[model samples]
Target: MIVRIMGEGQVRLDDVHLAELDELDDELLAETRSGDEEGFRRTLGALLDAVRRLGAPLPDDALEPSELILPSPDATLPEVREMLKDTDGLIPG
Candidate 1:
């Protein structure tokens, strides 16, 4: 799966990682819903970190469509909330 971290480049993640990413996605949604700013930041950082650690970074010039799009590391909670409202959390179930 191709995942895009906004403000960063794209990553080509294996399908096997989806389950783990989903768990983090769930945590992110929960944190956002509860208005836990600290938790939201932490979880979002973790999610982005996990993607960087587990997935291979695509070249900056790559133009493949991303299967999932995650907020940038510095994204605000309100921005994330608006993003979530338009779709499911970062990863689709």
Candidate 2:
């Protein structure tokens, strides 16, 4: 089953995905510690995809902003920047 994270809430993952992600995260940690480029890339890609699916818009959209503009014009840029930065260049245009 797919996990759903509603707005203003913590993200939840399916058990299988969570387990796999945990393993991948562990592997990522190991890879980072050991300087394994391929492992790091795979882990990073998986995590980034998870994040994107949680919040990103459809790929067909031509005018996607880094952080989607909500009703709040006074939104903090730093938080938005952090979320986008967390994507680690995994977001496709």
Candidate 3:
């Protein structure tokens, strides 16, 4: 799958990493549900780091669509809430 880190380029991830990503997604949901800003930041940082570490970065010129679009580290709670609402579901799949 191709995942996009907003403001950054895209990264290609394989099924092998989906399980870990799912766990991170679960953590993100929990943080959002409870409105824990600190945990949310930590979890989001971990998730982003995981994606960067495991996925191969695509060139900025690449025009392919991103299967998953992730928020930037500076994203606010409200922004993420809205993004989640717009997405059909969690991004692990």
Clashes of each: 0, 0, 0
Q: List the residue pairs that clash in candidate 1.
A: none
Candidate 3 lDDT score at position 82? 75
Please write out the lDDT profile of model 1 over residues 1-93, one tens digit for every residue. 899999998999999998998999999999998999999999999999999999999999999999888999999999999999866687888
Model 3 misplacement above 4 A:
86-89
lDDT of 3 by residue, 20-89 (tens): 9889888887787778998989988898999999999988899788888899988877777777775433
Clashes of 2: 0
TM-score of 2: 0.37
The predicted structure with the larger TM-score, 1 or 3, is 1
lDDT, model 3 = 0.84
After superposition of all CA atoms, the RMSD between model 1 and the true structure is 0.9
Q: Any idea what lDDT model 1 has?
A: 0.94
Ranked candidates, highest TM-score first: 1, 3, 2
In candidate 3, what residue range of length 10 has the lowest lDDT sum? 84-93
